[model samples]
Target chain A: MSNDKEWKRKLLRDMVVIRTFEETADKLTLRGKVAGGMHNSSGQEAVAVGTMSALDPKDVIATTHRSHHHTLAKGMDPKLVMAELFAKATGCSKGRGASMHLADVDNGNFGGNGIVGAGVGIAMGAAMGIKQLGHKKVSVGFVGDGGMNTGRTWEAINMAVVNKLPFICLVDNNQYAVETFIDRVTGGRDIAKRGAGFGLPSFTIDGQDVLKVNRYVKEARDRALAGEGPTLINALTYRYYGHNVGEKGQYRTQEEIADWRDNRDPIDRFSAQLISEGLLSQDEYVALHAEVTAQINAAVEFAEQSPYPDLSTIYEDVDSGLLGAKS
Target chain B: MSTQTETTRNTLPSYSEAFQQGVREEMYRNESIFILGTDLIERGGHFAQVRGIAQEFGLERVKDSPISEAAMVASGIGAGMYGCHPIIDLNFIDFSLGAMDEIINQAAKIRFMFGKPVPLVIRATSGVALGGAHHCNSLEVLFAHTPGLSVAVPSRAYDVKGLIKTALRAPDPVIFLMHKKLSGVRGEVGDENVLIPFGSAHTVQSGKDAAIITYGYTVVTAQKAAAKLAESGVSIEIIDLRTLYPLDEDAINETVKKFGRVVVADEAPLYGSITGDIASTATEENFKYLKGPIVRVGGIRAPISAHPQSAEAAIPTVESMINAVKKVLAY
Candidate 1:
């Protein structure tokens, strides 16, 4: 196989892995295996995979509550994330943080925040530190349409621009924030324009197209590393599930959901493009799906077998330095 | 005689000046230490607590943030997570409400949630004397209620200098409450660098009749009241609790047992106040030693009015402390 084929195959495999993981998470959540609430990123695979593919190993990312795809894309072990959802001691954060707070700092993924737009300032601060330390690295904050309406997001953008920090505000414009549509809540349809108002170079891209997202994110990363301040990329996509697992999603019509599922599926589009371009074969696609399914199944088995954290460790890790010590 | 000699050797600086000196020393020692807030760069902050810091540490280290308190505090948490020490100035304590989500949710819980240490220090000017509702508030009780945050309300210049240094170096997030009315008050701060650890209380004056537990500018008021009561042979022990969260329970218990009477004073609202917490703790722990009911002198349960008399009536004053002390003595 050629290098181009290998790259395409890898991207396809990552998207498959994300889809499989999120699908499994949705099932587990319904089965009452995963506590709290699970925010599944079933249809927004390309946004996570494409943007993460553009980042270097040292570059950092701060994700949102709906961040399973981002975690898998940033190279976190599937088993560890599954174990975290299982509330096992071996999970990331030592089972202290569940799905909404999954973080793997070793892989430069700062973790997902529960609050909307909360990660914006954190990513900007990390970018400011990177700039001050003279490191050629950028930080990306993945926010939802709900996060865009928050004042914290604009404040962070203004600060990033003023400080000329290396940062990217990736607004995953999935149309709806919970039940309310973006058009109903937001002042306008264009989320990227908010960044431009802060003097940032902003653009809008089709989130379903992996190639376009990868290209635009790579360009944004380049601009950031060159000390050109921050860029905002509003990736328009759709969610396959409700705001969280277990909800019937009574807000939208069945026809709209079916339309996105049939016509705008990121995986189906990417696979069709690959097969048409002769970069992938039908046999390879079937094998890739099998591989991802097996990988997800093994992760689920591992999480099911893992033990819960010890009750004695409840007070641990409250403060990084003073763990188990008095406040 | 020894206390007088120590005071003679120490430098006399106002609370604001002591804060400036402490920040300057820490910034000089730690390259990663930076201060950011509104009007901090050119104006040296609203109270001038960070005056001349930008000139000394360069504008890159001392930054002036926009009027965005939420970002200012959240950025501190982020910077601290990345191994940089950040000192964020909330222009007024009342403005902290604008950044409550950042302070109550993010800064206070991120370290615990992610299992990473965040050494972020927030300096907020608090009190109800000089300003109305918008500018004046003593919200240390709110911070003390938070699990991961350490709250310090230093009353004296000496304690402010030491506490600020200690807070900057602490492994946990800290909220340093500076009293607005005490900013111009001068006190003797030792020349040698010192760090006052959190959760410790100092006995401003030792007496046998009753214990007046207080913090922040109220400590000053308690001291004045204690002196006046001493003239009337009504002795009172004043315990200045510099830190609120890891409250010096040992010191409080000891004083409570010694005096057998208690009066808790604070500038916050009377209901659900830090003084109430202290009174509850003292009563629950040392109920046998109590010679009278634990009295509380705190802010009235209302918004601080702009009128001078109403403002004076809003918060606890030296007169109120004396009245509480006298009432407790009568018990």
Candidate 2:
């Protein structure tokens, strides 16, 4: 484990990089450079960063559609991720998968599934595979508040508990699923308690605090690796943007968004904590922000310059052709 | 002669037993292979297709999942993504509707999207057999329509054993559809490493007269119809397409050109059915060689009845195939 100063700096760097990348992606989408609409994790950075920080390089993770932060935090190359969003040939999925389907399997980031709550089973299976292979790696599945309503989530949770799979179910409760507030649709508002109902150790944490998120996730990971089965962590966060990029977000008032951004912004809270502890100076924070901005701008340039996949390559990778169907 | 007949009789097994034997053989060959589904470990599945597998492979390998088809399939996909080969037993084909997203979107598209091979097999029981709309369905067309999926509909014990083994070893995902009514149907299955490849069709009977093409349990009906038509001096040819998606277009073309008249039969609903796909392919490719329009014998466009008689009447019967053959010959 890193010291307090190193941890604060690393957390701050990850959060800023996520924020910068998302902001750049938003601009790119608006300008028609990015084909698919973007789902920015603007206010929900701390959850992804903290949870990912607790994971080892060998541990696998599966994310939801709003997955840029998770993908970046899981250590996927920013250049390749940006290229994928641009539909370039040099992308991670060879330009086949767009924003919602970013995956770096070699790096242990299984995928960013477009379907809600679908990753729960995938992560559970990965954990099962690890156990079968006699490895101690734990798999983490990230789902949104809306994903909890899906039947597959409960099924996966039950299976993980019964089988003693080393898995972690992270619920990012941003309080909404697309347009509707979660409470309006969900039978109950307490997302973390639902995990306990499935007979697993679970917790609800303040998602705006990166340190708290990191500590709780580390505990879960340790318990999982120690053969205690799965853990469900509900990170209470908020999305600053609408469900997608361009909407005005009329479902919730501007005041609510403003209150969250001002009083509960994860980046702001983390920055303040670092400054209060004398870990990061104001000058150092500004320089780090500038550095992340420059790095994101370079990634945008790389994506813009990257060539689109040739039309002839369209039929490639449909199947591995190991069984002799078209390659 | 009596001793030889007894030896031949001992070699034959029911469709379900052949399928179980195939799974057992593959599990023995590949240590990574495992089975999981709703009543697999406890009761050996609703159709008893996996009836003594849990005892042989142990409960750890033959897992009994919850009534969660989506998670079951998704977990299979995840396991397949890694180095494990999973054979997911979806009890009834109709129940696959609950897990279509995982089947069609995830399992079918994962390999294509990620450029990684997911070697998995989905064994689903299909066809109407004294069951209602929810229990009985031949929904292989839905899977065949998807690009990345390979579909296999085996009729006899011999074909099911070979096809199921092949599916387990295939590089991509395979949907193995077994007819529910044909579980008791017995056929001679040789004790050999018989692995049938997909995209190949079996010419059950050859003739110069009109041809009848079909798959699944309907192949049995088609063959029976051909035998009846033969009694009437009509030498109707029978072609059983084992796989649906990578259809043996060459076989369809060869039979259509030789016979000049054709009848396509399937157990699925008429609209957007596999039979329609076969008919369309035959007409499009063998239009110039056609002496008559291609006809389709399939299930009616209504909910399957729960009653036995009506349920049997819902899908194509031997009489329907025979009538279709005669109608095509007349045309």
Candidate 3:
């Protein structure tokens, strides 16, 4: 990684922002401030932050429904994201899409998909376009462990390999696709081993470690740009909350949640590592948390003050204008 | 701005050849345009709709994909969002059922949800021609019901060339359906630069009596029925609605106001068809001008069989349209 102190501090701040932002959104959703269902990615911040830090500004990424972390990590404005959650006119998508469908194409984030494994094919297509345009950019797609079993995902992987496109499939294996455990559907097989069937290099890594995640993704992006084809990385992580905010179920125990939150929290471990390396001090860490929480409060205030889209403009943007205008 | 050869413009081309020429001309004009589907590279397409595209534009533009309909359509949308404009070819319209989620939920709603322009086209051969249930289906109504998609069902060779050109140049997603039965039928075509705008209906035949409004292969059936009615001294007018989504309501209103009697025909099943929309438009907009009930002629609500006679009976026949016009006229 980089020896620059600012870069290290920025990484820590980024993860903290994602964590605070999601927790705030969850609280707002429960109080009926937000519009739609919010998928929390609080404990899985390292996977999004670390992997995204390795990408170039020109490189693109397609994400799944639980995407607040990825959207922010790709450099989207937090104010616009929070405004979208509130269904304001100034949202990233002009309030047309809420949390589950955030997108900023100019920022190289292709938006999140509600359907399982749908974003994978879309990312592969972007990779194909990049290859056809002769650009040195790699396309990354994030999927859950359950998304690996989808027929569409397999087809995308196979087609990407056949075309030799620059692509990366990042699996945030959180061990659960909703209430169903990954082992029940995957038959206890390693998600990384499944990549061998497609004839590409794959690896299983500790996603809790931000430095390792960053290094692995950087190598994959390098291979893709060198025309060496695609790579699949299974980043093992966990979610602190339920599948969705305020979900009512007994599938996971309180002890299990405590285990991940207290023992394997990505932000806590990374901060500890930073302190050990003398890159940060306990006093600085506390101050950083306060700064990020304040930033998130400002974003929420911006979303609250923003206005909803006018009813008269409902018919706008239905199409991109008619064809054969002059003829 | 066109690379069309003189030979292609002078002669009357078949529907398939006209479609191929339209794609070729568009690719020559737009470098970002590419065609992807099964059997497109060496085998040219299932119906030869893009025969020489691979040889002309090379492998990068003319891609032959595996039998993955969902991936093909999803990737096309992605490519369209990026820099490339893609034409995803589903060999048969019936095969589009496999990728309904990608087409309906993703491609059709991407622009509305994400506020990004998806400049893409999905070309598929529709209508029944004795093919099995897996091959023959008139599912244009399914796409017509969608909000962010434009559905184009062109009938003759002239329309095949003109409508495809319009679809290629369209800034939004378009579902361009070419009838399977009209692939080999030859007709007069305009110059290579001709483009027919969507929501514009072509008045095929004019008369003072009842009118028959339809599109796609059914337009040919309506013409035959009108010709037969002409011999019997019943002059039935015909209006061909080339595009379904951006419907030509003005033409339908004019036809309703002038004739005061109408018959709407479609190849899709009777319930929840395009005919319902046309009939509703006539009653809602021009109800007072109606001299009689607006009859709707459509196919049977069942799967088209492989048997030639059974398949023929499943769709709207010339006799069915003739009876529909007579019923409206006799009122």
Worst 10 residues of 3 chain A by lDDT: A318-327
Each model's DockQ?
A: 0.52, 0.55, 0.68
- What DockQ does candidate 2 have relative to the true complex? 0.55
Flag regions of model 3 displaced more than 4 Å.
A1-3, A324-326, B1-11
Residue-wise C-alpha lDDT for candidate 3, range B108-127, written one tens digit per residue? 88888888888889999998
> What C-alpha lDDT, on a 0 to 100 scale, does residue A283 get in candidate 1?
95
Per-residue CA lDDT of model 2 for B1-331, tens digit only, reads: 6999877876678899999999999999988888989888768888789999999988767988878888788778878877788888988889889889988888888877788777888888888787688988778989989978888888889889988887778778889899888898788775657788787898888887888888888878888888888898999788989888678888889988888899998878898888887888789988999888999999998889998898888788889888888888887
- Clash totals for all models, in order? 0, 0, 0
Candidate 1: fraction of native contacts reproduced:
0.47
Which lDDT tens digits does candidate 2 get at residues A1-327?
349689779888999999999988998898988867878889999999999899897798888998899999998778888999998988888788879989987677889888999888788877877776668789998999999999888988988898888999999889889999999998877777788889998898999888899999999999988998999999999999889898785799999999999999999988998898888999999999999999888888888899999999888877654443421
Ranking by DockQ: 3, 2, 1
Measured with C-alpha atoms, the lDDT of residue B83 in candidate 2 is 70
lDDT of 1 by residue, B193-271 (tens): 6777788898998888888999988888888898889899988888999889778899999988888778999888899
The segments of candidate 1 whose C-alpha lies over 4 angstroms from its true place after superposition are A320-327, B1-11
Report model 2's TM-score to 2 decimal places: 0.96
**What lDDT would each prediction earn against the true structure?**
0.85, 0.86, 0.88
